[model samples]
Target chain A: MKRRLLLVSNSTLHGGGYLQHCQQQIQDFFGKNVKRILFVPYALHDRDAYTKTARDKFKTLGYEVDSVHETPDPVDAVRKAEGIFIGGGNTFRLLKALYDSKLVTEIRKRVLEDGIPYMGSSAGTNVSTISINTTNDMPIVYPPTFAAIGLVPFNINPHFLDADPNSKHMGETREQRIVQYHEELDTPCVLGLREGSMLLVEGNKATLLGSTKARLFQRGKQTTEHDPGSDLSFLLTEAQ
Target chain B: MKRRLLLVSNSTLHGGGYLQHCQQQIQDFFGKNVKRILFVPYALHDRDAYTKTARDKFKTLGYEVDSVHETPDPVDAVRKAEGIFIGGGNTFRLLKALYDSKLVTEIRKRVLEDGIPYMGSSAGTNVSTISINTTNDMPIVYPPTFAAIGLVPFNINPHFLDADPNSKHMGETREQRIVQYHEELDTPCVLGLREGSMLLVEGNKATLLGSTKARLFQRGKQTTEHDPGSDLSFLLTEAQ
Candidate 1:
């Protein structure tokens, strides 16, 4: 099978219905025969919540899910799996833990070289990008870490939204933030994705899924909004 | 005279005018005696436009204007100034040059130790913080280059406004960003300033300026709003 990729969102789970959207996407990728390998990189603080939840979810799906923590080798568990899913939490913390354990490199190898069916939601999706420019965290404490799996050429700004009434900051809004990003970087497209939206990459083509809009930002100009209807087959078929 | 400090903004005499809001804050800091010291750190690429325009502005204020590239001893120039200003432009380029030249350290010393009045606009304000998390630029190709002057303990997210009508990405709004920042960081406050807003810090005390509300975010929670009022002597006196 081709290397399949699914990006789930971490914006909200309001009503305990958050995981349903993600389940639909997982089914789309794995189908009935899907065997899931879930990674909870962000729940280092609360293993029971993030990790156990994944185990329960995968078990319900009739697929086995295991948590990888201390290993002489990081890839031993993921390499044998057909589908890999990264759940969301504190992206910075999740990325920090992954880097500390040195699991990111292996995951990258599995996704990029081995072409495993890779899926990430929230923090998981964040790790797939070139960097986390769109993260809503402060720069005071450096996480002693860096960007995502480099699965795609662009940077991912997860949980992107417009301004709110309660805020006092001005300048380029989230859209403007992407515009500024384009103005600065030469390569690396910025993908501004909302919740329930997934960028599925299969065999050199990437496709946008779900209800929200997937906006693209290039260097030297403003952002242009794209939808699943907008020849998104280019995303699925684009070269690695 | 106090060491010369100039506040450089990303705005020009005629343009998008975003920097003007910051300029007004700097003026309030120095009052009518505001001595303009123009220092163009990145405009070296376009010598004609950046330098000529900076020089003209400085001459208009009856003070000396010099580029960081032109000054053989930037340290000396910083020492003799009443105030120093770094304007905004391509923030990445400006920061890269300052970081490469080691001017950021020298500028920091002049402000913190020598007690010279220091100011910045847009990119200028960005570099004053311990980190540039509020900067609306890409984090991937740029890396996490948050080597700013560190004049202030916290980060400044200026030009605060609500979201535009025509945009798509749905993440945390700007207010939510502040909340998330506070959740992650411990002490460094996230000051969300609107176009006319500013924060005056002298010693351990600080005050907020502008007619609009200034929101404070701490320890990963939603922002708490505060109206600074028209007068700011309370903060100035407290800082002293």
Candidate 2:
């Protein structure tokens, strides 16, 4: 079977409910066969509250969500999960939790080998890439390593925004930062997924979803803008 | 002798030459006696170019700058230096280079024990604190640890700016990110130092320098704004 994934830029759009914009795509991605999901809420500080919130959201979609924190054995939980959903918060915290629990490899096996459908938003979308190098979260804690689950070929910068021309802020723009990342580690392309946008991947093929255009960045190359419905499956083959 | 430091928020300000805004303060901090200085250019990718640029800037202030990269023994270079200056680029790269060169403890000893006058800008300023936890730089690489020189009691967020009210960016604002940091690690206070501002430390006493006001954040307490010249010595005492 082919691997299936829905990587969302953000759970909530401005003035919208949590995960409201991506619900239809998420529903279609999981389909009717996968009724139960193993949710990873480690990105959030208040895991219980985050899990409850996610549970309520998934419940409305007629899906039963069981957070990984509730299970005694998280590895076993991943193995038995029909579909996986990881919510957003802090990428460092999420990656650290994944490393601490030793569930990275297990989840990879389940998603890549067993072909269990996987979905993530924000920090979750960040970790779904080659590494969490492009995440915008503050490094509140130090993870053992920067390596992450390579569910996708390239890295994703969730909640991506263009630099405002009117702003006087002297800080490095989002593009400048990503360019610096390329200066150091140039192989993996970076996908800047704007709010309300997502990448739907099935096996080796990936499609850009939603109305907003996504930005693609590569080393020594001009950043190209891809409109919605453009095929981004070529990114998977370009992974080093 | 008391520990002396000039921790600058950034190297260059808007519409100013490199280190131009803080040259007088830097000169005053080092004094006429400290002629030869050891420079750390590890934060930047092109160390030679960064060092030469920094050297040219410091020469205008009547100081001889020698980068640690040029020396055969970096640790020894740290010990014998009259003064130390760390240039800005990436905090993770700077901290990682320090750890890789095994110069963290040596530099710490010189600054904290020997009372060597140390100056740093941007990423360099971030390492002068308890850890590089509050830095605004991207995590391009993983260092051995987040531990830094701890010359100051708290962490620093360089190039700090207020959130724009008119914009509709969905990402967390600078203040929100620091607040999230406090939620995770509440012991150390976070100082949001604007680009034109700096911290002048003498022994346990620290004063906010430059014309702009700096923001101070502590857990369970309301965020406070301090104008330039405000005494921040109290922060040194509150470190855990």
Best by lDDT: 2
TM-scores of the models, in the order given: 0.75, 0.96
Estimate, for each residue in B1-240, the C-alpha lDDT of model 1 and write its tens digit.
132333232343223343344445655565666465637556124645666666665564455666655777766776676667676554555676676676778888877787777767666777777667665443433433655667766666655555555534444456655554554534466566665556666554456654457655555445567786533223222121
DockQ of 2: 0.69
Mind giving the per-residue lDDT tens digits that candidate 2 earns over A80-169? 999999999889989999999999999888999999999999999998888988898888899988889988778899998898887666
Tell me how each candidate scores on DockQ against the true complex: 0.25, 0.69
Residues B60-165, model 2: lDDT tens digits: 9999999999999999999899999998988888999999999888988999899999998999999888999888888888899998988877888999988878
- Give candidate 2 misplaced runs (Cα > 4 Å): A238-240, B238-240
**Which 10-residue window in model 2 chain B sums to the lowest lDDT?**
B179-188
Candidate 2 residue pairs in clash (backbone atoms < 3 Å): none
Error in Å for residue B97 of model 2: 0.9
